[model samples]
Target: MNLTRPAGAVLLALALASVPVTAARATTAADEVNYVALGDSYASGTGAGNYSDALCTRSRNAYPALWAAANDPASFSFVACGGAKIPDVLDDQVSALDEDTTLVSLSIGGNDSGFASTMLSCQYSTLSACERALATAGEYVVNELPGELDGLYATVRAEAPDADVVVIGYPHLYKEGGLCLGGLSSAKRTAVNKGSDLLNETIAERAAAAGFAFADGRPAFAGHEICTGDAWISSSNVHPTAEGHASAYLPAFTAAVAGS
Candidate 1:
């Protein structure tokens, strides 16, 4: 028996046969991640130490650097800077992103909310003064920060349309019930931690609204908060230590990316 095939069917079959299967195997952004790390001090690994660049304080021990080293993605751009505010990120870092970018990780807004000043007041001044600073920072976080984050997140999404953006949140600085000889008082520590929670919540909400993944660093640094003997955060600076970046932020970021 002889089979007769339509001319159109035969032509289509030949055309399909001529195409290489390997051509269809061209890698996507996911298959070959072109990651761009952006944000402020936390993202730059300030207290983690072993800084590679003096200006940005871009530490090799930072979570972004560590992840890049471990995963060895197709490309990694570490543009996070110490003391980077929302405006700074918009002006400087967002330029690193483009259509080819697949992954992005950042922790921002703390600087914008005057977190450093608030912490300084809490550390050096009276409890009343600390409360005042906390109130100011909380007010900014609630009132001003959401709009800034929305603008920044919109810019990021516009630049890296296909990237899996992960917005990392700050960890609570102190272990509430833990012992400390003569640093911040328990009440001060509690207030600061609550402030940190509020900041994280604000960031999380904005990230969610922008369709970005939010990585909560609080749980990751749970037992390792500043007052804990085995603290992962630096007591002096209230920034994550090397171990904190390695164990806490790194895992939090990795998990967020995986889930994303």
Candidate 2:
């Protein structure tokens, strides 16, 4: 008849309160997801800020990190590295995956296309030279890079057979059919966007062939590309700002995984 909590009840409450929140999260292993992040600078959180590693630049603001935090996956591994190419994923990041993996998010192939060098060449060279450089990159994209993506996606599928592997593509670096300003000329911007489009197409194809979802970020990033003044990409022209990742990349990934 006494309205008092029992000693055992109080002790149990205290014990539960003392246990860390992560333990509570880990307890639901059956409902928890095992997410593995793989790919290049964009996936590595380079411009997202609050880097966990100087070399890899993995950030809490990166899309994968944002997704993990929002979803509270049972376990999450951020292995994506800045400048990682397809081979980098196969050689390093793939080890994080296994039969138990539930999800994967990747942004690669940009570096493989020598994206930075191509952009630099376009920026510094004459119009014809820039055109030629982009043409060459397009050749690699059409001729050689599909095979690389095929092998990478295939390996990811083989390793995590049941996982939803979402392959993320780069954003167009310029606004189309709009007033262009800043560093890149209208012609260069158009060429850059073309190369990006080709890369995205190839990636989407390979993802489809490998039975993975490809998250094309160009449409999501429309009107927000570099030189738009509302750009989500970093000033240096590559990688997304934190807002960019949150706005474009995050939504794309969420929708792809949801549809999957």
Error of 2 at 74 (Å): 0.2
Model 1 segments more than 4 A misplaced: 1-24, 28-30
Instruction: Locate the minimum summed-lDDT window of 10 residues in model 1.
Output: 21-30
Model 2 worst lDDT window (10 residues): 175-184
TM values, all candidates: 0.91, 0.86
Q: Find the candidate with the highest lDDT and give its number.
A: 1
lDDT of each: 0.93, 0.87
The residue ranges of model 2 lying beyond 4 angstroms of the native Cα positions read 1-30, 177-179
Across 1-260, the per-residue lDDT of candidate 1 in tens digits comes to: 44466777899888897675545556342399899999999999998889998899899999999999999999999999999999999999999999999999989999999988888899899999999999999999999999999999999999999899999999999988655787788898899999999999999999999999999999999999887889999998889999999999999999999999
Question: TM-score of the candidate numbered 1?
Answer: 0.91
lDDT (Cα, 0-100) at 241 in candidate 1: 90
Q: Write the per-residue lDDT of candidate 2 for residues 33-121, one digit (tens) a residue.
A: 89999999989888889998889988889999999999988889999999898888999999999989989998999889888888888
TM-score of 2: 0.86
